[model samples]
Target chain A: MGKLVYLYGIIPEGHDINELWDPEKSAIEGEDLPYVEDFGGLAAVVTKVSEDEFGETAMEENSNNTAWIQEKAFHHHEALLELQRHTTVLPMKFGTIFESVESLKQMIEEKEEHLQHTLQTLEGKEEWNVKAYINPKTFYERVAEANENVKAKREEIEQMSKGRQYLETKKLDKFIEEEMFKDQEKKAEEMYDRLAGYSEDSERKKNWKKDVTGREDEMALNSAFLVVSEDLESFLDQIREMEKEKEEDGWLIEATGPWPAYHFATMEE
Target chain B: MPIEQSTRSDSIVDVLELVLDKGVVIAGDIRVNIADVELLTIKIRLIVASVDKAKEIGMDWWESDPFLNSQAARKEVEDENRELKERLEKLENSMASDRTQIGEDNK
Candidate 1:
């Protein structure tokens, strides 16, 4: 069997690959160095891999291993990041392997138009991720203090008999929990709307469970925004404004940015 | 306004999810087998997007996943209820034991 080519991403035609640095002697180690396969005006940044290691069975086995996936995925991302510094890159998903370079070229040739359109749309723009988390305990306390209904329920519980008080308190806790969840969702939506105003495109990412996040605060909002290079400063300013406005409510905003347009690169179906 | 930048250096997890979720997929005739029985095939396509974006593109698996949806919250509440029931039972048992001991001492 012929060696497989691991495709990283596509870049526009005439991009000076050599100016970026020699792919043969890059610091992105532990894998084959990437090279460009030009198909007309577009080029695919790819690296060669032995079929034994990257074949179906081997890939399936490796997918189950977190360390292997992380290592390979990191290298793949590093290669794309490096290429992106020199030219706009349309990052491919990890493990996009072709049986051979000839087949890879043919595939690129077939998809050339769509690839060019995507690259043109994504040029000079980067993806920014903004995640908002709120300290649940403090947030609930603040909400309860601000809500009249919760205060009334608490007062009623205080006046009840011991048995009734215990049950009533439990009921109140459940009600509070439900209300807190609703409030969280509302806040997340509002934050997304505000941030979306500043972005060309925005996406609401799935909120990570507390255990998955490994954080004390609950994830209120997880989103990615596609911002133009010139609008990035304004986007950051908006985020800062939001932080000031929501800090009293125990909501925290975290942003990471100028990343490859991972969330905005979906090809039109 | 204090804005915090994400302190994560190893963004591999995100990248892994991204590459697997979004990107072009080109099928090829590559398969692994044992004794002429095909075991695996390399046909992968990924498109990573937010819930709304995925839905716009007709890919919304996360919405229906039980572990990632309201079912998980319900499970947590059920677990909490079970623990509370156990605690309530213990409290009632201890209260009964104390009353019986008091009656015996009075007699």
Candidate 2:
């Protein structure tokens, strides 16, 4: 049996190991290596990997197999969510694997105090994911209708000599790009101000990576909040109202959660 | 389900930000394999976010793209749908014919 490690989550102190842990499963069996299983209110599981078996070749065979990754990722999240329901856990992001259980134990022990504080602060507070998308049609239409300067520039270019017109159009393109960025920023600012009152902590996460949509330069204003469970309702109500209000502004405010604070929780090394 | 709306404060939360920007990053020898083909370890950054927002952004960008109006692509989608419908109808007819043949053979 080769070792396969699954990181569960970061937890606080005083978790009952006997109650929380299950005997090592055969599915994750490795050499009878000395297992180090200690959690700071957090428990991570690990099994050895037969380097020869899982070497680059095996993983390559499994890549592009969406169903395979999805299956494993879903189970991984399910396990983390299951732990989260009963304990204050900072769920690790999907696809986190380790070399061995002893390594996991050592890592946890080293970060025990930081993990504990994170758990305590996050206790009763769930992470909510919010994303805003600009409706391009509405945004463009609004820009065309409202910005006289833009219209004047376009008209001037249209009336110019052909050579000058080309130059003017180039200038106009630059102006449009700048205007687009300005609009994105303005919309982002407005949205942040609206939602900040509801969350104890909020941040703008920049998504520099390409996404499934294949759109380059998509603006993602990612943020997290520490909301008391009691206020969850009012928080939702406000978002619904804002959604209606910004329907024409090309703004999409989406929320997902009560999830573990995967973004906010950091291990103190 | 009642959608939990966010409150207005100076703080704005972007799902993309948290999932893409923030998180524990442990860099290792990264490798992505696909069908026995080892593509260079494409940096795999895990971004966890709300599915709805992602879809909205996708739809917005798609509709806004000038290329979406290309006749060839639009026709391709139409042809695909027509083919799918034809296949589905063919399957249904085949099943019906089999049932009728079986009934006649029974008699």
Candidate 3:
């Protein structure tokens, strides 16, 4: 069986691999950890795998198996994150492989300029993910108390005949749902805007469904911010403040990272 | 403000989604075959973004997916229920009119 190189990511020139990852502590089960390969000034962190397991057919089969994908993908991510702690890294997409180390080096040489630019731009920044969830029942209750339209509708329904009252109640429920969705969207926008002030760049992420998050609260905001290393603390502090301010509205904020500039490391043209 | 550092294990889902959805693709020939026939050709496409970062780079197929978009699925169910309710109302109205006509004929 032929051996292939499974590429993980690119690190800055002259970065020491041993300094980045401790083999004894960070080694993944059932997978070999990555080692750096110098290609001129840039280096690629890679691992060796048998062609039988990593070849097209085997990879296709494994991709379809959720369990296999999860295990392998997790290991792949861990290696990159480990490297990220030591130096700037341009993480490769999962499953990138080369026929030989020579070919991998050749590809790196060709893309050297683009790689250098990406590394330079992403050097001091880290990516942070902020997710905001709101308890729907509590949110609606607060809205009903504050909203004049809902208040007036409730009073109108109280004076109506029985049949009319039932129909009006249904209409009121629909109205409340519509208002709730609008309010959630508005709040998400406001939260994103406030956080954007602390970061070098920010992007609004697509809100996840309740099932994906496995949470009952509605996901009001999903966003990623590329913050400089110096601003990291202040950013976290502001998020805490926002959480406190919105607690009465049933808002919960979760922020994760100081991670590799995964969102900001696009290859320069 | 308390910031949570994403431990390697804690962000597996985020990492998986990122690596699959956004990353550089460097194509190479790594096909394996039998007896001069090509069986498999590997395409090396890598996505290196974290979950939310992937969304930033336009890797949001889950957003439009019916299974993942609970709100959209709920909307579809609501539409179907409305149609069924309208049909039931029509059936009840016709039945009531028939009874009225029968009473008038008897009188």
Kept native contacts, fraction for each prediction: 0.33, 0.15, 0.41
Docking class of 2: incorrect
lDDT of 2 at A34: 18
Candidates in order: C-alpha RMSD to true structure: 15.2, 14.7, 15.1
Candidate 3 lDDT score at position B103? 21
Per-residue lDDT over A120-236 for candidate 1, one digit per residue giving the tens place of the 0 to 100 score: 888888888888999998889877777666778888889999999989887887878777888879888998999899988999977764423536788889899988888889999
Model 1 has an lDDT value of 0.64
- TM-score on alpha carbons, each prediction: 0.70, 0.59, 0.70
Best model number under lDDT: 3
Candidate 2 chain A: worst-modelled 10 consecutive residues by lDDT: A25-34
lDDT (C-alpha, whole model) for all candidates: 0.64, 0.49, 0.66
DockQ order of candidates, best first?
3, 1, 2
Tens-place lDDT digits, model 3, residues A33-100: 66788887788887888777787777666664443554566666667777888888888666777889
Residue A247 C-alpha lDDT in model 2: 72
Tens-digit per-residue lDDT, B1-107, candidate 1: 33333223323334444555532233333432211000010101111112354456543433343112322333333433454454444433544577333223322
Runs of candidate 3 with Cα error greater than 4 angstroms are A25-33, A148-166, A267-269, B8-11, B22-107
* Candidate achieving the largest DockQ: 3
Docking class of 1: incorrect
Ranking by lDDT: 3, 1, 2
Report the C-alpha displacement of residue A51, candidate 2, in angstroms.
5.3
- Return the clash pairs for model 3, or none: A93-B46, A93-B47, B22-B47, B23-B46, B23-B47
